[model samples]
Target: MSYQALYRVWRPQRFMDLVGQEMVTKTLKNAIITHQTSHAYLFTGPRGTGKTSAAKIFAKAINCRFSKEGEPCNECETCKAITEGRLNDVIEIDAASNNGVEEIRDIRDKVKYAPTEADYKVYIIDEVHMLSTGAFNALLKTLEEPPANVVFILATTEPHKIPATIISRTQRFDFKRITAESILQRMIYILDQKNVDYDDKALKVIAKAAEGGMRDALSLLDQVISFGDNNVTLDNALLVTGSVTQESLFNYLKFVLSKDTTNALKEIQQIVEQGKDANRLIEDLINYCRDLLLYQQAPEMVSDGELGLLDDKFKELSQQINVTQLYQIIDELNKQQENMRFSSHQSIYLEVLTVKLTQLSTNSEADRVSNVDLSQIELLKQKIENLQRKVDNLSSNTVQTEKNNEPRKQVRKNTTKGQKNVKINLSQVYSVLNNATRQSLNELKQVWPDLMNMLSVTQRAIMHVSEPVAASENGVVVGFEYAFLCQKALEDQELIDTLENGLDRLIGKVPSLVLIPVENWPEIRSNYLKQRKNGAVVIADDTSEQSQDNDDQSASTQPTIIQKAEELFGTDIVEIKND
Candidate 1:
């Protein structure tokens, strides 16, 4: 026979053999023992967490004639046939390739027949979420009312993509990621069984690199074993897994925490030049920092197998850095990590990250405060007192002037004189009011806050004092509490465009903006109402020839009839003339 991979050779053959999935295996074993197994089972979790393995084990245990306590005897003919994929009753389907309506219809047709040699027929579909909508519908009826002595097992990494109806009909078991400790122990067991001399540190690195997948751990271990000529060493494991050694990470962090930018950049350059992945390097740093934090909080909890990066040097470094500095470092690294995802130049980002980390201060604010000079504190106190005295003198002077000169009325007059009036387009305001409806006004009000949130801070501040008083399909008249804000809002073209786009997305169309002071709005409305009561047409008296010329200029700037016709058809067929 050809050389088989460790993952294939070490595939879990029984419920007890499927490591890191005790809950799923225990429930399945009990279900088989009690004869309470559901006709349909949905196994969902991350890849390599034993979803398919558990399904196969359950199939064998239930079908084995010489089973004991829900455990299959591999010696039995049925168990051996299922294990060797030669059993007619236990079928395994890769839904990724055969996910079609016709394929599922064939299964539906065959489900009625009894098993050929076994007590029950088991169908295991892997990556079941890859099934088409039509296939899902086709299999729905069979899953809903499966024939006697028939079982359907669906396995998927992403259960959310499966339709809710199919999920509801099956008993679900969610497998969790295997812990690092369990993976490390499993690797040790396998290595000892093979009589391979291995360093425990190498096994630790391989387990951490596996990131909770037994199959991945075994695969990595296989590579490391082959690379080391059957001896699993730390250097070989690190080389195979592309993982940074604990010492390298500790030295890099030491440079960073000591504010040694030169050494830190050199370390990063060396790591990158060694063909270490930028993402993996950053991830290792992040994990190293997390281990330092954990070690600081609970030293006993930090073991050699899990977070093995926390060595004695790491403990000493953890003491040098405080909790606050760790938080800032992690936050900065995380932000840079996100930026590195979309960027093609990762080495430049890594260099920039080195500079940022080195520039970060190790001293917390409390430490700085404690080291402050007493003389400087007294000097600051004197400056604050002097400012307070000046403010008090100005307040007294102002109060005296107000009492003597009746300054309130004078100040009001001066304020009114200094404030510039924003000229309201009364004609446009009247038109909007005439066509306005409660529904339009309510719609504007509903989306007002969301629109405000979308604007920049300065734009939002300008629009803060404004409210939509009347609205129509074509325009909205906004009443501002202050005249200055109204004036500022009218002048901001970017703000106007932003509001138009935002409102268009929310309420279906953009409307023209009309700005006026709140105090002026009531007076304008009252004047228009009085003119209507007196049987007079309400029109702006400022409709002079210059205004008409301005309107004509604006109209001419708009798309002309010929231009619009060209747009509707094509510019190739249209002609323009200056005359």
Candidate 2:
């Protein structure tokens, strides 16, 4: 006589009413029809997957006097009483609340009784995993061998918590999660039966949000229906589901693709102000990009139900962003999502994420530029001309300096008040450049960006403004654009480790890292070249006691190749054998 929830009103009463579990339903139905029903059964799956509903249907079907083809006839008093939960022969228990030994003992004591009004007595226990050890032990023997005309059905979302002995006693049926398509169809059928006007997109949104749970889908549909005044509209559905509209997501992503950070942040602020959760928004964006990528690879695989509408705008956006760019954006977003999990200042992280995404998009666009483009060719020509002018100016300056016999001003680190200064070991730099070959430097440069991509967002941002300028067999000299970033890179040991590990994978050896400001890089390279031109071999001077001791130790002990391999690859990767 009162208004009931949609899930409650439309609860599956028969095996045929259960959606997205044809195999489970068919197996249960065949068992009942063939009169070969097991005395005990264990049903396991995610919630809203129709485990309990199937159990009830099975109970009613086996006891219904007028049952046909293993289906319960609702007209019979037995099926009607069971469906209404008034049948004395059918019992349903919540193990979560009554998960003690005493409660199980009570059930164990009652299994000897015969059915009062039906041919068989059925017991359905939901959330059976919550039963304590003693309670499980108490029920194990009874479940293995029940009285005649008695059946027990145990259902749980987590089957792993059930002991192996308890699990071995019953016939286990694993229910699968319902698909979004199946949920959408079920919602449409319900809405049509109720004659409620609903947008197809609205149903799709609810279905995707349900994540394969029919009860959740119906619950969300109920909320949307109530919010929409019984009219399931797209806006109402999005509001109820706390989902970003496809249009809004498309617009935000468009700004990101265009590298428009200002507009993108503006869009994000609006979305957050509207009360959308940060983690949820990030998850939706990831899914949206995943759908876009799927569409890019195979348009037919992505349907309207999965990706809202998939209109002309969606197609156009997919065309604009290449697969590689999508991959970069997704990876960056996933990293940011993980970072935001424990973060209190989520909005700040989101702002930072927006900037990173736009930067990635810009980098990807630059990478896609054609090598034969006239603009790039012009840019290269200008750079070459500038280098030539610089060379000529240097030549003139050198002649003047020689005439005056003046020493060139020493290129030193420029430190200002409150400015952090990164200490670059000049001796180390000299050594790397001393042994640096063109081949090593080129190889480092080739894999630098790829290595940077493997780092976390903060590390990547700091390292992106740097380049591998010179490298040797044992070390690399990276030049950062700013002194602060250079200092940050020097202090971040994790970043250093990640870079070294990534490099080891990319190229076969792990080289130590040396960082310096880009402002001083040209001078450093120029000074090193000048010293080499003058036939001055630059080498690291051993000044520290540790260095002297290390040299002494090396002189005394000759390390075998196995020791070197162990040092390079770690002891775990190297094995030694007796000769």
Candidate 3:
């Protein structure tokens, strides 16, 4: 026989041998003992959490002729046949490869036949979420109502992708990720059975590196064992896992906390020279800082099993740094970690992070040195008084200039009565509205959806409730559903620029954007039309007196507006009969 991997050699033969899934195994065992097993079962969880293993164990246990206490007796021919993968009665299908309707239809056709030699015909579908939509639909009928001797076991890492109809027909079981402690104990047990001399700390490191997967832990353990010449030493495990040793992590943090940037960079250089990953080093440092925080708050609760607890040196350093400073360092490192993913120059980011961490302490020391001296207090006060006197003189001059300019502002206000009350360049928007040709607007409206699709999600959401009510060669007036939305749209300069670019792409011209509330659209249109009819160019003004004069002019022009309103709203709604 060829050399088998540790994971395959140590594959759990019985449910009791499975680690970290007590609840699922107990439930399946009870169902088998009570002879109340469902026809179909769905196992969903992260990869390597014993979903397929449990399915195989359950299949063997249910069909074993000499089953003992709901456990499969591997001595039985029926159990042995399934274990060796030579049984016609038991089938394991990889849905990733056979995820077509034709493959599923074949299963549907074969599901009608009875088991040849076993009590049941078991079908274990791995990565069942990979099945196509048509394949899933084809399997629904057979899954919902299979033969009495048939059982379907569907396993997938992502359960949310499976159709609800298929999930509803099966008894779903969600497997959780195995804990590090559980993985550690399982590795120790396997090493002990193999008579391999290993360090306990090394096993813990392997367990941490596994990230809650038993298969991954065993595979890493196998690699470390070979690297250590069958002796699983701490150094070999650290090298195999590419994990920073506890001493190196403590020394790196010590240099950072002490504000020694030179030594900190040196430590990073040493770590890089040893072929350690910068990203993994950052992650380990983050975990190390987290342990310090936990140890500071509750020393008794911090244990060696939880990603290696802080040592004496780390505990001493923890007291030197306060919680706020530690949190800031962690936050800065996390941001750097995110940036490192897209950057090829990862070492540069790491060095920058080192400098940032060292600066926190230096900045605090600088803040301490910046205290005011009592000897210079009187001099500072005198200088402040002189500054106040200069500010008062400047304020008086400003008031006098405003008073001298008041009459000129009033004269300008009278000149532009039908204009806006705010000082904005609305002449371009006004011209667009006045020369509002249907062809320009219709061209923009035709490609509005394409233009909108070019915007980001947030921009699309903000502009979804608005539409182009009026357009011209150089500007377009957009009307929004609510007043606040129009206000918000006008305030976002970036959104305006994006809209301009998008419009330029779609309509071949970058038009100025004008936003208005839909409720104010009619009044604004009426005012513009009234001003245009009076042969007046309405320039925008910010003076209050100008707004009041415009209101008075609107009241006087009601008779002309009524004639225009009759054309739009009909004579009945206009009601110009002596009113």
Candidate 4:
């Protein structure tokens, strides 16, 4: 016997050995047992599933000369010949090459005759959907009402292409795609029977390489066995198909997840240089990203569904990132894949995409540094700072206000006209209180610079009232002139004591400080005269004037104390109503 490949050798000689189509197998067995077999049967599914194989088995069961129960008795000479494809009564036709009406007419003429040897004559047509409409019409009449011992079996990967009228005459069976686990178990049994020394990982590679096609899995195992030299390791299987090792893809994904684009891009380049199929990489990447997104969303529970080939590291990678971020990454990569289809510079596009993804992943990091707000916020804040400076200037004590439109300089100039022989002797007075210095004088400058300017021109002894004592124990009296009300308010002893102990103390010789009311100034002497004479003063008007000092500065001092206070303080003082 010539050498047969494992799939052809172990080609499911009996219905019991077929791997993942138990439902179809059971139904066929029951039909045969119940003797309810139809005249025409249609089997449809994807390639590598047992659609064609099932048709063969049905042919064998119906034709077996010594069949027992529902199954063909393989011990008999008739059953063995049928299984070995030597039966003259059964016909197997390939519709792909014989799709013409003449070929189908030959089949139509042959079905008219009775069975040669077997009880029933079975015509098995593979890829029957490939037949033209004329061919289907030629066979339709015989298919609907076939001879008593004649049966027609049509198998196709796509049943939808067949006309409904032709389909309606036949009983249809849909074969399901086999699962990876089911394919794996079958591959294991084959390897054990062949005495093949193979790793489980190699078996997994063959199973996943099948992608639900049992024939594809067998073909992969055959190819790997030829190159694998009796040691079917993962590396051998990977090399046979120019396929990437799952570990390489997983490692690159790990580097990508770490935001280490440098290594990830390098690894992907290595993969491309190895001549691995780029489409497979994309498909695996999409699956990887989907699993990661699912695991990220719900750590406690994740169903493996169709992606059972993914290993434990894939699950770990899935749980490594947030679901939302993973989805964004996958969507971006998918868009890149679509764009790559039209671009001639696919390598450059992939490299640029990798760099951009690295930059994006940096941005996606939970600990990403916030960017500095360089323009609008800082510029508006600067403008606010300037406005704040203006507000601060209004509260400063130096900028004094005038009641009317007259400038304060003009008022000070007019008030400077005083009697030369007044004999105030301010220095001699300040000597009585021990509160007189430039330190105190600067504060006087802060509030009473105009008055101090006037007093300095006279060269009299005047002192700023920083802390002038008034009790007799100090042998001094503290007083202030009408021009220096603001200067007198600095009589804070705690501040004065701190000043006296400093390097530049404001305290000087003791002085008897007296604060004179504005009326006592030489500018308003008539008001003083009325008060001392048990009399009152009259207000001056243009029509009537009781007393007028046309050239005198002391004519207006006769106002009451409350009137003077109101005039001096103006709006700065609040007057309470007694009502």
Best by TM-score: 1
Which model scores highest in lDDT? Answer: 2
RMSD of each: 15.9, 19.4, 16.0, 23.5
TM-scores of all predicted structures: 0.63, 0.62, 0.62, 0.59
Per-residue lDDT for 160-251 in model 1, tens only?
A: 99999999999999999998999888888898899999998888888899999999999999999889899999888888888887788988
TM-score of 2: 0.62
Candidate 3: residue 413 Cα off by (Å): 57
Off by over 4 Å in 2: 304-308, 361-579
Give the higher-lDDT candidate: 3 or 4.
3
Candidate 4 lDDT by residue in tens digits, 350-402: 67766766666434433342234456567767775665554345424322432
lDDT of 3 by residue, 26-49 (tens): 999999999999999999988878
Sorted by lDDT (best first), the order is 2, 1, 3, 4
The regions of model 1 sitting more than 4 angstroms off are: 304-309, 361-579
Candidate 4 global TM-score: 0.59
Better candidate number, 2 or 4, judged by lDDT: 2
